[model samples]
Target: MLVSHQQNSILKHESLLVKFLTKYLSRVDSDIYFAKSSRCVTHSFTKTATVLSMANDGTLDALPVVGLAHNDDKKIPRKRVYAWAFWDWATQPFNTVLITFVWVPSFLTSTFFLDPDVVGTAGEEVALGQLAANLGAGITIAGLLIAFLAPVLGQQADRTQRQKLQLMIFTGLLVLTQLGLSFVQPGQEWFWVGVGLIAIGSVFNEIAGVNYNALLVSVSNSKTVGKVSGLGWGFGYLGGIIALATVVGLILSGVLQGDSALTFQLVALGCTIWTVFFVIPIFVSVPEPKTRQVGEKLGLWGSYVELGRSVKRLYKEARPTFWFLLASAVYRDGLSAVFVFGAVIAGIVFGFGFTDLVIFGIALNVVAGISTIIAGRLDDRFGPKNVILVAVFGLVACTTAVFVLVDLGTPMFWAVGLILAAFVGPAQAASRSFLARVTPAGREGEVFGLYATTGRAAGWMASLLWAVFIQLAGNQAIYGLLGIALVLLVGGVMLLFVKAPARSPR
Candidate 1:
């Protein structure tokens, strides 16, 4: 008896089909329920049914705007939609500039920070290795905090309907932390300062991501979520490319003044500015979602209890998604390590010079951007499960190639390393698509927060294994590839046990 959305006649029919499906979806008392298309989720009979979501053609007819106040604003406007997508475009520099391509391994691991007191006693190699290990430790500790807090924060945002507000606050904190990097000059005195700032910036970045991801449901539906997610992810990689290009340009034009430390500091400042100016459109264009009708907001302690119940609820009612989170968490961390340690591997194992590495990084980002966008389309057509399987399999093969062919020189790296890079974004984007498909409608924020938490839960595994492999091989770093590949392979194998969500048609 659900009314059809007037936007598309085809969707009107689809809505009715979804209404019929809803009868089954609402039977939570059953052992489990499966819905087609991740975006078509509905919550109880009282919540909005995203029935007219995905279609056979992959493009969706616009549904009612999530929080539009005006009756005439029935369709999702193009301007607003594009503005919403720009958030990924704006924040790409954090990943590309600070994390992946430019900052951490290249500068923080440099000899400039070696303590005068320990330079001789500790040995330069030992000192540098400790810096790298210390950085990873900081992130691990941060991950634990995130694992504990993200769900709680997300639960609060869902009830209050302030997902965007949460995003902006953390984003602002991230910018401030990025700005603090300017104070971290050379020598032991300032090394921990740099590490602390990056760790804190990472926290702000991740916590903000919880709200940013939840916003996906507000701006998109089943039909377009895959491509939109792709677009955001693609833009993010492209943003990193652009940020790195700026660094290249600065170096070429002599704007960086030949001080490597100064260059990194300037790059961090530029990334901060990029995030601030670009994140404005979402606030200006996308309104906060209407508050949920799902009872009173729980207190923080109660939210944890509710989260436990929610997990139990999901286990009984959405078993595939519950297990999928556990599986995806492990692989996603491995995917992250591919980038996190890639530059290090290239520098230490394959002997890539700074310029060689930077150029290669730019090329890698370009590949990731293109691959993620294409895979988004694939995600829409073949289902996210299929896309993820292919990407992860490709990752395992390509990563193994990097390990097996370590003796072949930079040419080997150029070939298989780029292949390794190509699969990473697709796996990441598809996993997000996979989760969105099964998540109940009203709880997008909290569930996506769980998505972030679970992903962090196994955050230590790949990094720990990398250390283990390196030590086992008598510190021959090439053996570290096996560590990362093992995690991805195990995680991918787990994905096989997770059944794909049923697909709905328009």
Candidate 2:
């Protein structure tokens, strides 16, 4: 009887092992579907398959940490994944349409917003420089606010499982701010109001992003997280391409023909509507993340204390994650400066017209989307840290080339600028994947919140240096590129010393 029982136990174990290997090996480029059975073969150094639970119907409940939940069906639904990705598509116009390509450069700093007296006395170049400098200052202030609020809010959301709710509230605020932009008529009186509105909108956007990024675990497993992150970023770039193209089409079609202020006002209104329409799918289709044992919730002050303790714990236990946050913070600021100032550089330095800037934005998004998707696969194969390092190296080289070869004119800017765009999305996507990998179970919101806080804490460095460098170089916008490149270089070197997270078993 004892010998027979031992033989039955060994057969069962071998059957389970074969089951896991079959599903794991079947994984392809985009996604991998595991069995609906309430069992998972979690990664372990022992190379042994361990079952967590069992259910008669075989439907698997979510696992801790990585948030892998299997639906009743055998295959993961594509709809839920796409719906989650659409959130990125939805919010992208805030960056591409309002912040980067259209509103700030073409209208806010235009002659309409300048003091008639200053333009006459100081020349348009000097007036534009002042406006640009002021914009940087406003963005810096917004970053500080994000640094203060993100960690506290993130912790509360993680403990309470209110990530989706918080994301919706902040998303609403962001939309309202964009709506408010329509009322920012072009004049000296309205310039600061425009700056203030954009600043507030920026804060809302970053906070909302903290929750959205944390939600990544809800829809992905350890195996597919890199690809899923890349998909979301790709969607964003593709959305940017469409939004910018629509604006350009409107401009060329004369549908948006009017005074400069009215044209820009219409653009802002269009973006607000776009955000509202596309953002609904995420809230509707993607279910809220399941709650876990992330400790008890704390009040505002207690939350801050908790945050401090969490930081200390991270430094001690997850040293690689801690170092990654610090390193990513610096380069992320530089990456942000590229978009925040790209249009301004094109218009002010390269002499790109309104249509030309829009066209350039369209082309930039096309390359960015494609490269990010391709790099996602590379991230899974080579590891996210390797992918990030390569992208940063490319960014540094391209940005430096843009600054040094400025006199070569628009052709040079277009060539090097497109190449620069290609690296930006890949670096951003891989960074998210890296963080997702190291985050502990049930702590996605809090960790990504720290990610946002750290990024925002150092966020002022690039903006400040951009302003400082431009001022030091006689307010030449082209010199600001050097400041951005320097930040990337420093961040890349820091990343080299930080260890990469261990890869999960295939």
Winning candidate number (lDDT): 2
In model 2, the runs with Cα more than 4 Å from the true position are 1-75, 115-125, 403-408, 464-480
Candidate 1, clashing residue pairs? 36-502, 38-437
In model 2, what are the clashing residue pairs, if there are any? 65-441
Q: Which stretches of candidate 1 lie over 4 Å from their true place?
A: 1-41, 45-74, 117-122
**lDDT of candidates 1 onward, in order:** 0.73, 0.78
Query: What TM-score do all the candidates reach, one by one?
Result: 0.84, 0.83
Compute the lDDT for candidate 1.
Answer: 0.73
lDDT, residue 417, model 2: 90
- For residue 426, what is the lDDT in candidate 1? 89
For residues 1-506, write the lDDT of model 1, one tens digit per residue: 00123125323433553354335224421211111232323453223223433335534321212221111123444445556666877777776777766677667767768877666673777888888889878877778888888998888888877788998899889889988885678877888888888888888888988888877765555555566577678767776776677677677777674357777777777777777767888889877654354546788899999999888877765667689889999899899888877777999988888788889999998899878877876786778889898888898898888888888988988999788778988888888777766676567678888899999888889989999999999998888889999999999999998877544342
Model 2 per-residue lDDT tens digits across residues 266-324: 88887887788779888998766764657778999999989999999778656677899
Which ten contiguous residues of candidate 2 have the minimum total lDDT?
Answer: 43-52
